[model samples]
Target: MMFEPTIWIGAILMGLSLGLLGSGGSILTVPLLVYIAHEPEKAAIAESLLIVGIVALTGSITQFLKRLVDFRLVVVFGLPSMLAAYFGAYLSQYVGAQVQMLIFASVMVLASGFMLRPISALPNSNNTPNSINSRVDDFTVLQYLLLIIAGIAVGTLAGLIGVGGGFLIVPALLFIAKATMRKAIATSLFIIAMQSFAGFMKYTYLQSTQELSLNVPLIILVTVCAVFGVLLGGKVVNKLPQARLKQVFGGALIPLSAFILYNNV
Candidate 1:
């Protein structure tokens, strides 16, 4: 692929957003892939899925090595998510690009709203690591069943757009699994990486003739930049008030969604 400065800029922004938000940032990737890289909608969506998967994996691996992952929940959510993602990819093959863009924009609007909500805190007693250790809380059958349902919904959204579904996953873990905010974020990243990989593969299999229309060199540069950005973002995350940060990040998506919808339509 030929080099393009525009795509490079887009990728840098994409990485920066991911670093800042931890989720919903991948929502930028598809639009950037289309408008900046000048790729067809189908190709852009497919490639964006792959890139987001890679980025999420990179961030997740960093978190996982710290033993932050909730693998049991990941498995419960991921299985149904993968299956739903397959159906979503199949549906995308038949849907019009304009319609898809509209749907994608709607999903972003919802995600933005979700992000803007007040951060829910776990009980003070439960917040302690020792308290958590004393309780041998395994997933109940009900938890597993609920996860499958949530996964189907989230995976459908991810497959419909190029999002990694971290936005949904984070909140779901908090509300459903009753995890602390830190645990929810860490687990969200892990599940997002898994779901993105599954969703990307599902879409890729349905899609023939993968297109690399974007500036590959620039993509590499942006990916490299993201490594540092995520490190910085991780530091920043600890310093900032999470509610304020989430609101700022969530509110930004409105204009972005509007712009993409307007231009694409």
Candidate 2:
């Protein structure tokens, strides 16, 4: 089996970021696969969905057992996202790889801006974590519409750009659905997994028809390393400052995005 320590290290950090902050893994995964592991951009994008989907699903399970998931929002937000992601992946075949990279890099820049914001700032002051959780059944027509629209936007980006779109999902849940940070983060993971697998399935169809290839062994190795890193990060999450971690990760993305833009343009 081909092995690269640098790639494994990136995987560990990608997973660690996810475990510590509940997001940011996708930003690392796609770059690591494409540049370090040297996978084709399209194939790397598809593989990233598989890797992140597995990790995000695993992370979401703990929140599930803790009863933190809002199933009503999951149905309203997740189902449409999944279908949209599938369609987005199908549409990807028409776009050039360089154009896709440009889109992904642009998204990374946007995601970094969101990460730099304070956690409480994501939701309005009136919608603090201490704010009482409201039933989805009580949501206004506009709120329901917001949830559905947010889901579709995040899902399309996930399929087109290979991002899990958790950065987008969490904020939408906080602002539109008024979910507390903890609940939004957990729910975001579940939605991302659904969107990712939907996109991956569509990509798999391309593999057969377009002569694209996925490096399954590389994907497996990266997934295993990332999961291990998640476990390690979980043990230290309480010891670390999540805000600082997000800031560092956000700052790091700036240069990485610049590098991608340089190459793509």
Candidate 3:
């Protein structure tokens, strides 16, 4: 099938969003793959997993080199997420396209809500090790439970919708794990990488029964662009006004979500 130039534009923007925002860009992949690229919902979701996972893993590696990632948190949060994501991907075969789009649209709305929040309102994770240690001491059983639950939720969503779940995972890391913003971002990328891959593998296995196939060349093209975008984003992240960026991106989501819901409903 011939793809329009608009689809390529959307793919570039999707990667750019990942590079710039870290997490929000993957949300756009499903819509782009489905509507612009004209792929089936299930195939779009599955392809999104591969695209988001590759981009996220590249970002995570950059973060790791800078010592921003928390391996301990990755283990604590990622294990359950990986398992749940696989299950969710497997279960997705039973859901209809319209229903899946409805669910995905709802999630887009939720993610927009998170994105619209002023960054200033979030807790600063700039504490020194000694200070962070004290806060860590206050971590309780409830927080642990919340972390596990959050992990499962993120994993399942990643599997079901083909998102990286970084929007949800970042907050959970900040609140439940008491990770600093840098740590949370870095760690969230790691978890997303794991969850997305697990989901993608499940989807691949399930694809045996379906006649639909992924556009491997398109996937490669988008992945390459996204990786470049991540590098570019990393370089300019400090110069950009993050709050304004978030606000704009968040505002854009509202209309997109409504559009999806309108079409599906």
Candidate 4:
């Protein structure tokens, strides 16, 4: 299949979103794959898991080097998410394409609401070890249960719709783990890497008949371009005001969400 310029352009934008916002890019991947690349819904969803997983893993590694990730929190939140993501991927076979797109669009709306919140509303992190521990210790049993539930929900969404679930996971971490915004964002990347990989694996396993083969060259091309875009976004994110960035991205999502909903509906 001949690759369209829009595919590469979308890949760059997706990466830039991840690098700058840290969570919203994967939401765009499926649509780009389906509309611009003309991939089937199931195949696009499965491929999105791979793309998002790799990007998140790359970002997580960078966060780890910066000592921003909370491994314990990742374990607590990620295991259930991984399992649920697997189940979601398996179950996707029973779901219709239109239904899946509708679900995906709904998630975009929900994610947009989160992004629209003021950055000042997010918890501040000192980026200290003691502070991280204190936040974890403060979580009640009820919060732990909530974290598990949130994980399951996020993982299911990732598996079903091909999202990384960072939009959901970051807030869940803040509320349940009592993490700082930076830690929540960094840790969310790690969780996304694991859950998305699990979902991708499950999707592959269920494709026994191999009804659609993955576009290896296209995936490689998009991934590479996205990596570059993320690098550019990372540089720009530090220079931009956080609140302004959130407001801009959040406002953009409104119409994007509406477009998805309208087309799917």
Model 4 scores worst on lDDT over the 10 consecutive residues at: 125-134
TM-score-best of 2 and 4: 2
TM-score to true structure, per model: 0.85, 0.94, 0.93, 0.92
Provide the global lDDT of candidate 3 against the true structure: 0.82
Q: How are the candidates ranked when ordered by lDDT, highest leading?
A: 2, 4, 3, 1
Question: Which scores higher on TM-score, 1 or 3?
Answer: 3
| RMSD of candidate 2 to true structure, Å | 1.9
lDDT of each prediction vs. the true structure? Answer: 0.69, 0.85, 0.82, 0.82
Query: Mind giving the per-residue lDDT tens digits that candidate 1 earns over 160-262?
Result: 6767777788777766776655666666776766667776787667755433244456446656655555555655766766678778878988998898779
Whichever of 2 and 3 has more TM-score, that candidate is 2
Q: Specify the poorest-scoring 10-residue window by lDDT in model 1.
A: 127-136
- Look at candidate 3 and give me any clashing residue pairs: none
Any runs in candidate 1 off by more than 4 Å, and if so which? 1-10, 17-20, 120-137, 209-222
Q: Which scores better on TM-score, 3 or 4?
A: 3
Q: Which tens-of-lDDT digit does each residue in 143-201 have in candidate 3?
A: 77888899999899889888888879887887678777767777787888899999999
